[model samples]
Target: MAINLVKGQKIDLTKGRSSLSSIMVGLGWDPVETKKSGGFLSGLLGGGGGGADIDCDASVIMLDENGKLKGKENLIYFGNKKSKDGSVVHSGDNLTGEGEGDDETINVDLKRISPSIHRLVFVVNIYNARQKKQDFGMIQNAFIRLVDNQSKEELVHYNLTENYAGKMSLIPGELYRQGNEWKFSAVGEGTMDADIGSIANKYA
Candidate 1:
């Protein structure tokens, strides 16, 4: 079982696990059906002219020791699925939050990552949310977890159940370096700006 983490909590993954080289950060979420005040059939099916498949995308931003963006290519998402040095790789994009389990999985190799890169931040945003008028408020069961790839054991997990109506982006957590040790932090923060591009621009 994974550790159900609270906001602002920190976990040191590299403490006892000397063999913890690779980890899979799995993210999961489900869409909340928007109820409509219409006919019986419309209400039965929860039909809504506005409701549609919410496309949520997960991304990883590699930052230097000073918490600065290394480069644009370091931002891994559906657009750029792989990192430059092949240290970090996003599995793929999850268009809809329908399927069971993680919507997006990001793989990180401790050995492959550059020493200068201090942190890898995990972010999720609804694709074209401004056009869809969607945010985390309408989404439920949103979570991000870290696991030991080899052992198949979940190290830490955080489930977000907050009302983020006007926000479109979520800063779930981050994997950072503590001397030779690596640690994970659960940060469930939200932002109102549109897409991932706007969020990335802030760091650039």
Candidate 2:
């Protein structure tokens, strides 16, 4: 069974697993239902009534030993789907959180990551949140998980259950290196960041 994690918890990803090198990280969320449902009323409401689709873009900001971005190309999202070194790859943008399970996924090759890069911070932000007047308050069942890419088995799962009403972005979790091993931290922190670029600035 996969370990269910709470906010602030951390887990070791490559401690004893000698052969483990690649892993799949999945992120998912759903929009909360509104009683209004569709039409001009829903559009004006931003969501639920279905005025506009809540485009939550998942991104990974690669950082160095000093906890800072080394280059602009290290940031991976819908526009830039893969890392320059080819160690990390994003599945692509999920325009709408309309379906079940992992709306977006990012695959990481532990062995392929550059030695200088020490952290992979996973973030999710509502696209044009301020313009659309949307936030996590219109979202539900947000989660981040890791799977053993080779065996297709889930190793860790973190369901973010927080009241992020006015929040526009989330730093769900991150993978950082400790010596030769990688560790996963369940960081369920919400932010008022307007987009992925704003979220990446904190580490810049």
Candidate 3:
């Protein structure tokens, strides 16, 4: 079943018959532009920035019982590996922003997680490709969803573009579990330059 989660709702995983063995987190958004055309010459000559374009890098984190990182072993980050940053690894940065295929998918093996794990966090970063200061209002249908692999169910869904900030962020949704299925919802919508830390602080 597809579960639509609103802000402030909590899903108690321990109450479920099956203690979340694994979780798949998917980040998706409506692509602003499908293709980019022309060059600076075409623009300077009278073309202007061709087509609407939105590019981004995103990541996810898991919070342990003590409200600290479960380390790289418990988390999956996607995007550029710039400056050898521990969490900068990305599956692939989508430039087209076409909202197709898997923009960002993080698979967590619950078996590997210590019993101490308490929450999961998601973060999305918009690259500001156009270098313009715009808010999430310019975007549409952006969301984060958690799925159960065994039952093929959508455990939780969060609609963010309605009231989220552009740039780096912690997706304001946390998933635990409820009645054999995980549950989650947007908690507090806020923007931050630090994706990993902001997420960790929620449980901390």
Top-TM-score candidate index: 2
- Residue pairs with clashing backbones, model 1: none
Candidate 3 lDDT tens digits, 73-103: 5455543222122321335566645755446
Best by lDDT: 2
Instruction: Write model 1 residue lDDT over 1-204, tens digit each, in one string.
Output: 788899899988899899999999999988866555476434433345445789999999888888888688889999998888898999998888887899999999987998879999899999988887677776779999999999999989899877666788999999999998999999999998688888888777
Scored by CA lDDT, what does every candidate get? 0.86, 0.91, 0.54
- Candidate 1: Cα lDDT at 121: 86
Off by over 4 Å in 2: 36-51
Tally clashing residue pairs in candidate 1: 0
lDDT of 2 at 88: 96
Q: What shift in Å separates residue 95 of candidate 1 from its native position after superposition?
A: 0.8
In terms of lDDT, model 2 sits at: 0.91
Candidate 1: residue 93 lDDT (0-100)? 80
The C-alpha local distance difference test score for the whole of candidate 3 amounts to 0.54
Candidate 2 TM-score to native? 0.93
Count clashing residue pairs per candidate.
0, 2, 5
State residue 178's C-alpha deviation in candidate 3, in Å.
Answer: 11
Q: Quote the positional error of residue 157 for candidate 1 in Å.
A: 1.1
Off by over 4 Å in 1: 35-50
